[model samples]
Target: MSVKYAKRMDYIKGSAIRELLKLTEQPEIISFAGGLPAPELFPIEEMKEVCVRVLDTDGKAALQYSPTEGYMPLRKIIAERMKKSGVEISPEHILITSGSQQGLDFCGKVFLDEGDTVICESPSYLGALNAFKSYLPKFVEVEMDKDGMKMDELEKALQANPNAKFIYTIPDFQNPSGITMSVERRKKLVELAVKYNVPVVEDNPYGELRFEGERLPAIKHFDTEGMVIFLGTFSKIFSPGLRVGWVAASPEIVRKYVLVKQGADLQSNSMAQREAAAFVQMFDLDAHINKIIEVYRKRRDLMIETMEKEFPEGFTFTYPNGGLFTWVEMPEGVDAAEVLKKALEEKVAFVPGGSFYPNGGNENHCRLNYSCMPEDKIVEGITRLGKVFKKL
Candidate 1:
């Protein structure tokens, strides 16, 4: 017997990174595939204390079901944190979700319909692309430069697809490309969004992880007409296992998210919410994030230096100020997937770049993650990848 599946299932495919992770689980494989934070930095000792405190203080509420809007204390903490991004919001306007990935799915649910258009960077986050693809929207890819997505190309796409659902972007240390949008372009993006009357979805998982340079204001900071939806997560800074993230928007927009949340899972994990809140209250989160920044900075530096010395000429990768991954562009006519097969023979793994493009074609690229590997492994992995590229 065959099962009947929704048509959306046909367009949805498993994440390339997720699949690559399975192959790299072997102890000998030096993987540069996943955007994973260093486990050593996780506040396990502090969390053990935090967990005990939560159970001692609010055991009943921690285990009990809560509102779809989320725990008030946690929401207030998130609202306070938004100020760093230059957005002034009240807890009432924020809805906590399982993760920012959930917020991405809710965006597609709220805004997209079959045949609708989505304007995104040429090579955007694979997770976001997959989330939007399930709704069967037509993706209008806009090219990018060093600063970030090309504003002129974005404007052209907005003009062509006047009925676009929303403009999705990762403005800070973007996922695959690791390019940050300039301040000038961030303002211009808001201007264009207002002109087109389209809402902007800003997925910012790495905004606070800056290793150098002054922190840039979020794109939502420039939004005056309440058309920007900011998605924030602790997955990068604090922990991904907790699966805590939030959606900050206008009260009306948040109400829509609240309704959707009720239908999705009724509410997020209450125990996790209390644990996160208690952890922040009991310790210095900023100090903890600084610790993370220090380690990731060294890792990023090592990975970049190794690639510079080892990678063949004609191979190029980004110098990310702060993020998990750097994108490598291979010489023309080379497929990264083919290169990956040879790399795996050397017990090395990475994600090929072609799948990052929703419309597909560019295959001479790959994303290498530095945040997960130690300094020694980073050097070894790059050297192995370098040998693989040189052979081709």
Candidate 2:
């Protein structure tokens, strides 16, 4: 006999991208999947030193439950880092969660109600879509060119759906697509949010990893009202394993998050928070992040060069200034999932792009990650995947 689950279970499902990533576990496969940072870049030694110090100095407090809003010291650092993106706020505006991933889920918990609409890029982060789906929100996907989400479609969606909960975006180097919204679009997005009286969720996990040009001011930087809830994480610029991330919003919204965080785990890991705070205080993360940029910039350049020379004429990919992925678009009518099947047989793997679109049907695309693999593996994997594309 099968057990009945909540009706909400009908909306929630396992991530297709994650399910596909399991296949990448094979030792022989060179995976261009999983938006993972280069593990070598993690400040493991520095963190070890920090952890030891924390244990020696304040082991009891470090191990005990902390505040729901996060460690004040860590929040202060996170708030200060916002200056790079042009936002200037205090630690009081921030609420730390286990990771930005948890922040996404809380977004659903705090704001969404079943049958409400969420506006997003035509193809957005698969993980965000999954998180929001748990609350049974319908997605209204707005089309985007290189600049960002098309304004007309977004305005249209907001106008039609009075119950649209939030406008979700990764305005910096976006996931899967690697599209950066233009400054004009960023400002216009704030204008629309103000006009429609809708909140904006600006997720910026990859903003700090800028490899070239000036980093754009985040949408939150332009907020006239407290309608934008900004999500940030140390996963990209530091280590993902630490699971430290934060949300900055108006005091009211931050309080809403704190209430949920109390129920959703009481607080983030106590020892990890203290250790991360100590590490941040003692070391210069900007200098460490520079090291990461130096390595990733080279890897990105190499991957683009290889793909330029190796891929079939019908295939094209993004030349993102920063971020772990490059979006690939195959010739019309080809399904990337099918291309993935053939590539896997040749020992290469990637996430099919169809999974990124919340409202489906862009089967001719896929995302390739260059950060996790070595220079040699990037070359080898792209070459192998190219053969599969060429055959098709």
Candidate 3:
């Protein structure tokens, strides 16, 4: 039973949130550990109709093998949607992938080599960190303020690491931190990438989920030199189980993704792409997203309010206008993992923020998800967690 594995496997580990999900699966546990969407808001009936229509009209084509570049109609729909984010793109430059998670893997495959450096926000998305880690690259995490990653620190990192592969960012209501990059910073980020001659991988799964303020243009929108790679997904706005996402870049760049796609999984789910396109054609996706915004905005508001009233003094958390998470920073000496142990005793769960950092050592933080739980459960869970933190 002896076997050998690749060296890259040494850098890979199971996701902290994924492991926590298993522990919190009990019926009574009020889990806020996962960045999951509310199941009640899914378009089950519309999808049911869309599925039968696709099968009845184009059954074989729906199930058959598709181009690595994805279904033309779906790509076109995605391209049209890109205009909302201020990017004028064509379907020819889009390559469909299983999910944005796969898009992250492709970025690693295309840009990284052993000992290469990656520039990311200090507390970036855990999933992206794991995906990039498989390539054995060193991470240079930049500090962040309320407006997202700091530009001066990013410039210093870029200057310090000349062999940096790419700058990875979740600019729109960023995961774990829930901070959005301002419009000026978005433009400055592109400027820095252009100057540094490094590509910017914009992981924007939550850009469209804005609950307040005007929507800002994507980083790719400012990329006149085609140095930005935009990853878009249906997981947040539509069905995650469909596993439909795309890489929108320049033609030359996306052709590389298509080649990678052929080697990765051949193509994304054909039926799922067709169904997503049909759903768009058959219904008002904007209205559907509006419904999601209404529900999640209320949840976000309630969670922030409850935390304000219940949590003790000196503990700080973000009041996110949109997205799934809000990060809580405990006092310097406090360990969130210890807080979790006590909270679990009261049938509650959340992700400790230490694992969110690729280089580690911020154990006094935690990420809370409000988009998955009901209002009553959110209140009850935050109250229980408040008591746990107060004890510490």
Cα lDDT computed for each candidate against the true fold: 0.93, 0.91, 0.94
Candidate 3's TM-score reads 0.99
Candidate 2, residues 1-392, lDDT tens digits: the string is 99999999987889877786787677798988888888888888898899999999999988888888888888888888898899988899999899999999999999999999999997899999999999999999999898889988899999999999999999988997999999999899999999999999999999988899998999999997999999999889888999999999999999999999999899999888888789878899889999999999999999999999889898888889888889999888999898888988999999999988888899999999989999999999988987887788
**What's the lDDT for candidate 1?**
0.93
lDDT order, best first, reads 3, 1, 2
Worst 10 residues of 2 by lDDT: 16-25
TM-score of each: 0.99, 0.98, 0.99
**Cα lDDT tens digits for candidate 3, 1-392:** 97899999998999989998896568899999999889999999999999999999989999999888999999999999999999999889999899999999999999999999999998999999999999999999999999999999999999999999899999999998999998899999999999999999999999999999999999998999999999999999998989999999988899888888889889999999999999999999999999999999999999999999999999999988789999999999888898889999999999999999999999999999999999999999999999988888
Q: Write the per-residue lDDT of candidate 1 for residues 230-250, one digit (tens) a residue.
A: 999999999999999999998
Candidate 1 stretches with Cα past 4 Å from truth are none
| Candidate 2 vs 3: which has more TM-score | 3
List the lowest-lDDT window of 10 residues for candidate 1: 16-25
Instruction: Tell me model 3's lDDT, rounded to 2 decimals.
Output: 0.94
